[model samples]
Target: MYRRSFALVAALAAVLVLVPAALAARVHVRVEGKTQTIFGSTEPTLNVKANALDALDAASLAGEFYYHVAPTAFGPYVDQIGRYPALPGSPNGWVFKVNGIVPPVGADQVTVKDGDTVLWYWATFTGAAGPLTLEVETSIVRGKRCFFATGRNDAGRASRVRGVVFTLNSRRVGSRSGVLCTRLGRYAVRVAKAGAIRSRTYSGR
Candidate 1:
């Protein structure tokens, strides 16, 4: 009896140790073209274990935003997030992708794993949304950390925009013509063009 009790307690302790690891999948989420009002994390990443819908719910609860999910034959469909609703007679709505690929499953069914990125953007299904992709490349030039940004359309074609500004922590640091200098702390870098392009934010170290 004493041996069985000791083994039971040891097994319970082992399960407790493993439960947190299983529940702590890191996932990055981005809601493009909207003001950053989600959980006050760095770039809206889910450091805890969560599915796609779970991440959205956590953000909505933390940010006090509204989101609706409708039951469909396939699964739960996202009807509206915040003030944006699916447009009638159009494919415009909240479309999402995991790891840069559009998944066939609904957000509720999509299980997010560690190091996976989930992007939710509000735009028409048509390719004219402008700057569907944005990336910041960092390198060391002349012993200084430099950042270069690029924007691309849905067709994977690059975009040419004038006066591309790089903002660090909401402050404009430099333009596209020049390399941006970095600071010690983590900075949220946003690059944008006027009118024809949508802005994208990336984390800079």
Candidate 2:
């Protein structure tokens, strides 16, 4: 009886020691203000965190990305998946990849983590309802650092304006900075390391 009791205690101690270490190996991402774990045999995935409400309010903020309302060859860029209206109706909606390689809109539902990269862009609105705009900030899973871009109705609406910006610390790299700007409807930013980007964008007005 004594020998059997000792063996049971030893087995319980072994389990307690192993369980914590196993839990530490897992990782999670913050989406819509909720934390979720990533389960897979993969090392890297398109992992990013977003505060969807703030993203939609990016317009009307000055010095960011603003445009004028004018009906011409350029008004608003249409999305592929949702086909959401690109003007005053749903201005604070959708984030896309403008890196020329992959252009996807509406990243609110998409999940990304450390070592992941995202490119964001928007279009100008020109109609009887005036102009609309949008912005999106990207962050890594574990690091919690952030980088983002804002759109505006510049050029009075004949052209669509956009830009790309990012941070190095949030990317898990170091203190690094850069900026990618364009008025022709495209931009690019490089993901160098965990929290560093090829460029960054700052607004103070």
Candidate 3:
């Protein structure tokens, strides 16, 4: 009876250990460097432990890129991603935001929910607010995916951004809304402009 009880207790402990991992959040992660979209502009889906740092780690794994975290007085700070690190007294440092807003704390201290989008980018802060972020809105019409683009500043004000270039399967497509699944299936769509961070990679079925 004693042995059986010990085995049961061990099994319960095992189950408990696995629960948190199973409760891991499913998120979309995007990393943008100074010149181009570093990662997740092609594949953005990942399941990770709940935090912005975990989301970044998952992106590093999926994209096979590199990142570095440094300890700070507040908490662990991600000072580098890919080939870029935070420059001293320079605006070209790294910053992260969940769903278009930078949290009031460190990346390791922020909790990320399921379906959240985590963006890590090289920031070139010219003012209090950061750079312009881009996003795409898509709709289905007659089995075609119609894509519309927009840009928002750190102030949360958003507007339609025209002259958006659509890249379907890594090829520049002419029209935005005329692509259908018959032309491409189970693929990614990324839009870009001149001086804005690229939009999240929209996947089509």
Candidate 4:
């Protein structure tokens, strides 16, 4: 009887251990217009266990935040903004370094938790090509998928080309034809044509 009781106790202990292990916490992340629901925690310290960093890193790369991550450790956090090596000789340019409550520009030191929003705004600039702007709005919505949209326009010398632009979010799973797909997480709007500004939504439900 003692042996049987011991066996039962051991079984119960095993179950107790397995139950919690199986019920791991999940962190859902959405990108562009597509929903990526994942199960895990995003604590930096606990990264060894589930490694939410990898998931976030993948999302960041696939989404609009790709530009925010610096080429080096201590470099242009928000390169898309006005003054960067990318935009040589650009005048009358500005970046939302500190807009609203969020710091538009951040270093690699910044830790993007599970529930965080990253917005990238491209304002007008003064140059020969004019203000070639590519704005992307990104955020993790309901921990389901990363949502984003991109709009491009030109101003100043290129003011005549101030109008609609469109790009595809191929990161979305099983996407076909840049249009008509849930894969439409974000857009890559560029001045499709010059002349007039025509606003349009290039995605679906």
Candidate 5:
């Protein structure tokens, strides 16, 4: 009995030593809600603890937005964010993804590693499984400004986004040939479409 208790105590000591180091890790976070990008779109990279909810908590404190989490059967559920609430049969709600995947568990249950990207956005749901998301990438080469955009569903499946438009430095520009040759300089770029969550801003120099 004494040997078993000693082993248990050693295991607990190991866990206590590991947890604090993980909590200080850096995570890239983005909050998209309502009519515009709330945080991390044009802002700097965010710092978070070890879960998706921790990233949201950091954004809420830094951006000074209101959010509420409720204890549910599955786990902790984020029911309200900013001015939007996940109501019964209402379209206004929130959805989240870590590294482009909708995690099967709740945000608090999912453990996030360093450099993981956590994105939470307000979405209007149609049915049970709806509301697509967009991922954007930008690059500059030889004075040519280029963008690559893709749309992802709730399942993290990707497809090309149709009729993609870019907001570069607050100027709206449309792409016809899948590439824009705007003069390359330090700029911030965001992609949008007709019916998807707009992407987090990508800055290029």
Candidate 6:
């Protein structure tokens, strides 16, 4: 009976060790529409076991990017991301969202779970016109995928754009034809159009 009890205890201990490893958070991190690092000459999707800041650190970009956090009554407030600083009197700065909804706390304080997605974007507000926006549309034409990217200035007017580019899975795809993704694997579409300073990534099904 004692041997059986010992065996059961060992089994329980094994489960206790395995459970947390199985439940460790797996998150996807993207910066400016590209994978964070190139591992062995191939861009691998970043999956972290901790929060967003931990994921950024795993990518070796924790100190490479510029940012500031202020000690606030609530918590640390992220003031800047990259070169975009939150203006003192403007509603422009770095805006971040997890799975499409803006969090009420800073990125460091937001705990992520498995299969979570973190997106960080820069919002530019200049001179009261409005914030510049870019939109990308994908379609299937002649059984081929195509992408149309448009950009609008602060005034909300479509302008003749340049530097509009597209990439799929971290590989640049031709502008005339959208990425011909023909597999069952995950794919990411990144678009940078007009004079926009940053690019955005759209996950594809």
Cα RMSD (Å) per model? 4.9, 17.1, 4.1, 13.5, 6.4, 7.6
lDDT per residue (tens digit) for residues 1-205 in model 4: 9999999999999999887445433333322211111211111111111332333444454443443334645553334322222354545322321111223234333344433332223334444433232232334445433323332332212122222333343332211221222232445321222222212223332
Q: Please provide, for model 3 over 1-205, each residue's C-alpha lDDT reduced to its tens digit, 9 standing for 90 to 100.
A: 9999999999999999999778999888888887888887744679879899999898888889999999878888778888888866877788888888877788888898888888888878778878778776677666765676777777557877777677767787554442323332465777777666777777865
> Model 2, which residues run further than 4 Å from truth?
1-94, 98-105, 124-205
Best by lDDT: 5
Off by over 4 Å in 1: 1-24, 33-41, 47-50, 128-131, 152-163, 173-187, 193-205
Write one digit per residue (lDDT tens) for candidate 6, span 50-94.
666555444445335655666778766666655556767776665
Ten consecutive residues with minimal summed lDDT in candidate 6?
33-42
The Cα local distance difference test for each model comes to 0.64, 0.30, 0.78, 0.32, 0.80, 0.55
Candidate 2 similarity to native, TM-score: 0.20
Reference-based TM-score, model 4: 0.26
lDDT for each residue of candidate 2 in 74-128, tens digit (9 for 90 to 100): 3333232122234545544223332112223233434333334333333222443
Rank candidates by lDDT, best first: 5, 3, 1, 6, 4, 2
TM-score winner between 2 and 6, please give it.
6
TM-score versus the correct structure, for each prediction: 0.65, 0.20, 0.75, 0.26, 0.80, 0.50
Q: How large an RMSD does model 2 have?
A: 17.1
Model 3 off-target regions past 4 Å? 1-13, 140-145, 173-188
How many steric overlaps are in each model, in order? Answer: 0, 25, 0, 17, 0, 0
Q: Is candidate 3 or candidate 4 better by lDDT?
A: 3
Which residue ranges in model 4 land beyond 4 Å of their true spot?
A: 1-57, 60-85, 91-105, 125-205
Q: For model 2, where is the 10-residue window of minimal lDDT?
A: 32-41
Q: Residue 162, candidate 3: how far off, in angstroms?
A: 3.0
Candidate 5 per-residue lDDT over residues 1-205, each given as its tens digit: 9999999999999999888756665788889887888887854566677789988998998899889999888888899888878997777778789888888888998887777888898887677775778777667677687677888888889887767788888998887544555776888778887668898777767
